[model samples]
Target: MHAIRIEEHGGPEVMRWTELPDPVPGPGEALVRLGAAGVNYLDVGARAQGTGGWAAPAVLGAEGMGHVTALGPGVHGLAVGDRVAWFYHPGSYAELLAVPADSLVKVPDGVPDELAGGVLMQGLTANHLGTETYPVGPGDTAVVHAAAGGVGLLLTQLVKARGGNVIGLVSRPEKTDAARAAGADHVLVHSGAGFEEAVRELTGGRGADVVYDGGGADTFTSSQLALRPHGVHAYYGPFMGVPTLRPTDLPNSILLTYPVVHHHVATREALVRRSGEVFDLLLDGRLTLRVTGRYRLAEAARAHADLESRRTTGKLMLLP
Candidate 1:
């Protein structure tokens, strides 16, 4: 099997592709012959700083879509030849991955491997954010930073589908257009002065009912400022960098929530039930899986470079 391994963390240049022994599934696990692997901001963060939780020489990737090539002992619900998509903490960026049986979800008919790969992590993040964290309603308004990025695009659509209005903040004009196409009611370019004030004006002075701030350090303060009193502010990622804040930094009246999807959807039942709803939306054509870029497995370094430099939009996938 071929895999990209990080012996040390620093930059995309550190990623090395090499032939490796195939991974064998353990009890309650399955070996997936990966078709496509999703590239996420977390992978970039891991490559740059190392996953603070893991050691060196780690395989980095969170989600992928593939087929069950082998099922280990005690893995019953899934079988060899079944099309599946899975989320793994550290080993999806390979030709073969040993994923816990519990993490595997059967891919629906007609959903391509690329699309499935694109959505698993980002789609599940959007589902938990929209349905669990803030639970946006018809008249509610949300301000989503990086609205043209993978999770942002999906989150915007899910919020709109629930009848909420979305105020999308993007770093570029083209991304602004993409955000609007994804169902944001208004798109605001973040470079302009008074960007936070613009969000207040868009919400008719009360501010957004919820603010999804994945931009981390750069937009953290503005995100809190853009939320209404008592409104929730959810911070998930640190695409800019991990946020450092003082106790007084947040608005006194607002509720701050840092909900990690990994913890929120910990159980197999929870993960599947939540992901099933997302898949239903995708299948019904209500949700669009926007795959903005694709690269071969050996080009994993280039993929990371594009994501880190913000040179790509929506979801990026690595085909194996």
Candidate 2:
């Protein structure tokens, strides 16, 4: 099997496309022939600084869509030739993956493999963020930082579909258009001076009922200010480096919460249930998975480069 492996952590250059031994499914696991794999910023972070959970020479990818080719002992409810997608910690950036049977979710008949691969991780994150973490409601106002990025765009659309107004913050004008296309009611460039003021002005003096802070260090403080009195601030990612916050940094009238999807949806059953709900929304056309870039599995290095350079938008997929 061919997989992208990082023998040592450093930069995109460290990601090597090399031949690796095929993974053998263990009991309660299934061997999946991967169709597409999603490349996330977490992959970048893992490759740059060895993922704390794993040793070096590790295969790096968190989620993907594939077909089950073989089932290990005790595996049931899935069979050979079953079309499925899964979320796992590592080993997805390969032609074949050995994933736990419990991790596999049957892909609906109409959802293409590409879309399935692109949306699994980001879509689920967006679902938990909008519906569980902050619970956006009709007439609610929210701010999404890096709103043109992968999970950000999907989250903006999901929030708006539920009738919430979204104020998006991006680093470029092109991203502003991208966010608007994804249902953002207002878009602000985060680069120039007065970006926070722009957010304040857009909300007409009063700020948003919630602020989704994905761009960590660069936009955390501004995101805090963008929230309305007693508003919920959900800080989900650290694409810009994790920001530090003190008790005094938060508004007296607001509440701050940092929710990780894995922690929120703790058990396998919970993950499957919440993922199914989001999948239904996707099938109904209420949610859109915008795949902004696609790369061959062998071009994993280039993909990481593009993501780090901020040359792409929305989801980035690796076709196997």
Candidate 3:
């Protein structure tokens, strides 16, 4: 088997793709022959400085989709040859992965391997943010930062599906059409002058009902300012840098939360339920899974570099 291992915490060069012994299933785990793996900001953060309780000299990645090749002892829900997708477990950037059986979700026949891998973590993230975190509804206004991003595009669509008006924020002008196509009511340049004021003006000085800020350092303050009184602010990702929030940072006593997806879907039942809804939306054409980039397993470093550059839109995948 082949895998990309992080030799040390640093830049993209730190990842070394090399051969390795094939992994075997352990108790309550299953061996998966990976078809595709999801490339995420979390992976880049792990490559720079390890997280999710991992150290150097480790295979890096958390989500992937493939076929079950072997079953471990005490695992009964799944069998060999089943198509599956999973997230949160590490070491997914390889030809084979030994992941817990409970973490595996059966992929529908209509969903391809690449789309399955690309959507699990990111889809569930947007699911929780749009449905559970703020529960967007008719007549509500939403401001989503990184609007052309992987989760951003999906969240924009979900928000619109629920009849909420979307004010999408992107770093570049080229991304406006994509955001608008995703059902965003309005698309605005995030780095441009007076973006928060623009949001206020769009809402007639009332501000947005909900603000989803994934680009932390660049958009955090503006995200807060764009929210209406008693509105909710959901901060999930901090690509630029983490922001500091004080009580005075928000006007009108707006709500602030840093909701983690893992915590939202902590139970296996919750995971299945939320993931099933996301897949249903895709299968029914209510949600479109945009896999904007692809790379070979050997090009893991290049994939990470592209993701961190923030030039790419939608999900990026690695074919193993």
Candidate 4:
């Protein structure tokens, strides 16, 4: 089998396509012949920083969709030939992956492989963020940073479905249309800062009820300024480096949260329930997955470069 491996921490160029011995499933695992693998910031950042819970010479991917070709001893509830998608699994950038059976989620019949693979991690994160973390609902005004990015796009759609008004924040004008298409009621490009004033102006001085900030330091202060009294700020990612907060930095009665999808869907039951909900929404056409870029598995470096460049919208996947 062949996989994209990171032999040393560096830039996107550090990712190498290499041949490897085929892997066999261990007990309670299944060997899946991958159709597509989701390329995410986590994968790219991990490859660059050497800090994604693995070391050098590691196969670096966290999610994929595929068909089960073999099962190891003690595996149950999933069998050979099952079409499945999983998150938090390593080595998904390969032609075949050995994933724990319990980690697998059945992909619905109509969901394409790329879509399934594309949404597993980001969609699940959006699910918890939209429905559970801050609970965006009727009459609420929500602000999402990086609104045209993978998780942001899904989060925008889900927020709209829940009856919340969405304000999407992006770094460039090219991303605004995609964010609007994803259901953002307002899309703001961060030109010369002071985006908080725009949010206030759009909301008629009321500010947003919730801010889903994935951009970290670059947007944290402005996101803080853009919140209403008692509003919640859910900081989920560090795309611009981590930000710091002080007690005096926020409004009175404000709530600050940082929800990670893995922690939210930590168990089989949680994973199944959340993923099922996302699939239900996707199948019903209430939610959509957009794969703006596709790369051959051998072009993993270019995929990472495109992602880091912030020029691509929605999801990027690798077909093996």
Candidate 5:
């Protein structure tokens, strides 16, 4: 089998498509033949800095869907040939992955392989923002930064589905339509800050009920400014840049939260349940998975490059 491997952390150039032995399922593990792997900024962070569990000399991916080719002892409720998807298992960039069966959810009939493969990481994050972080409700307004990006698009659709209005913030003018197409009630073209005033104007001076901020530091203050007093600021876009602030730096009575996807799915039961919620929306057509770029597994470096350039919108997938 072949997988993208990195011996050192640096640029996308560090990722190498190298040949390796095929993986075999161990106890409670399912051998998954990689159908597709979602390329996230998380993977880029891992490749560049060996972030978290992704140390060097490792395969580089976290979320994906695949077919069950084999099952190990004690792996029940799953069988060979079952199509399964996982939200996070690490080492998912390979042609085959031996993932713990409990870590996966069965992909239902209506969801396509590519969509199943790509949606969970970002989908679940969006779910966390809308359902838990702020609990969006009817007539509430939300500010979604990078509204054409993967998480942004999903978050926009979810906020709208939950009866909240979305004011999408996109980096370029070309992305405005994509945000609107995803059900953004209003779309603003922004390069850095300054979208707050428009959000306030749209909300008639009350500001948004919550701001799903993925713009990182450059737009942090503005994200706060866009929110209503006591409104939630869910900052999940640390990859763009991380900003620090004193407690006194907070404006208004706005609540600031860094909602981690893990906290939302901290247990096996929670993982299955939250994943079901996202998948149900996909099946019902309330949520859409847009694959803006698809690359052969070997071309992952180029995919990373495209993602980092911020020119690619929606999802990018790697097929093995």
Candidate 6:
């Protein structure tokens, strides 16, 4: 078997594709033959600085889909040759993985391999933002930062599906079409702050019901200012920069929360249910997944570099 192993955290150049002894399923685990693995900024963080609790001297990646080749002792509800996907499991950069069966969900029919392989991590994050952090309803307004990016694109569709309006934010003009294509009601091309006024104007001065912030400190204030009084501000990813705030620093009586996807799907039943909702939306044609890049598993270093450059949009998948 071959996997991307990083001896020390540094940069994309540190990732190396190397052969290793094949993994075997352990107790309560399933041995999966790798079909596709999702490439995420999380992997880059793990490689570059050992962020996200993934220490060095380890294989990279946490999300993917594959076929079950074998099951370990005491495992049930799964069989050999079943197609499965997991939202969180370390060492997913390899060609085969012995993942806990409880962490696995059966991929439903009509879900493409690419979507099934990569959707859960970012998809569940979007799901948590739209459902738990703030349940978007009809006539509600949401300001989503990085609306053309992976989580933003999906969150746009989710807000639309829930009958809410989306004001999408993009860093570049070239990204406007992508954000609009994902069902954003309006797209704004800007940097840092200064877009709150536009958001207020779009909402007729009442301001947005919520702001889904994926970027870090630079846009933090603007995201908060764009929301109405008592509106929710859900911040998820902070790979860019972490912001600081005092309780008195908060404006508009707005609520600020840093939502983690694990809390949204804390149990196996919740995982099955939440993932089913995402898959059903995809099957019903209401939610569309954009896979903008695909790479060979051995070429993972190049994928990391591309993601780090922040040029690629939507999802990137690695096929073994």
TM-scores of the candidates are 0.96, 0.96, 0.97, 0.97, 0.98, 0.99
* Better-scoring candidate (TM-score), 1 or 3: 3
Q: Quote the positional error of residue 73 for candidate 3 in Å.
A: 0.5
* Clashing residue pair totals per candidate (backbone < 3 A): 0, 0, 0, 0, 0, 0
lDDT for each residue of candidate 3 in 1-320, tens digit (9 for 90 to 100) = 99999888999999999899998899999999999999989898788977556788889999889999999999988989999999777889999989999999999889988888889888899988988799999999999888898889899988888889999999888989889889899999866325889999999999999998887676777777888889998988665578776787677798998878998689999988988998898998989978889999999999999988878988899997
The candidate, 4 or 6, that scores higher on lDDT is 6
State in Å the error of residue 311, model 6.
1.4
Q: After superposition, how far is residue 183 of candidate 3 from its true place, in Å?
A: 1.0
lDDT of 6 by residue, 219-257 (tens): 899999898999998987677778888989889999999
* Residue-level lDDT for 169 in candidate 3: 90
Candidate 5 structure quality by residue, lDDT tens digits, 1-320: 99999999999999999999998899999999999999999999899997766888989999999999999988889988999999898889999899999899999999999999999999999999999999999999999999999999999999989999999989899999899999998999997998888999899999999999989899999999888889899999877789989989998988999999999998989999999999999999999998999999999999999999989899999998
Q: What would the TM-score be for candidate 6 when compared with the true structure?
A: 0.99
The models' CA-based lDDT, in order, is 0.85, 0.84, 0.88, 0.88, 0.93, 0.92
Cα lDDT for residue 170, candidate 1: 88
lDDT per residue for candidate 2 within 72-132, as digits (tens), equals 9999899899989875548789999889888888998889899888787888888888988
Runs off by more than 4 Å, candidate 5: none
Error of 1 at 227 (Å): 1.3
After superposition, candidate 6 runs with Cα above 4 Å error: none
lDDT, candidate 4, residue 202? 98
Cα RMSD (angstroms) for every candidate in the order listed = 1.5, 1.5, 1.3, 1.2, 0.9, 0.8
Best candidate, lDDT? 5
Candidate 5 Cα deviation (angstroms), residue 113: 0.4
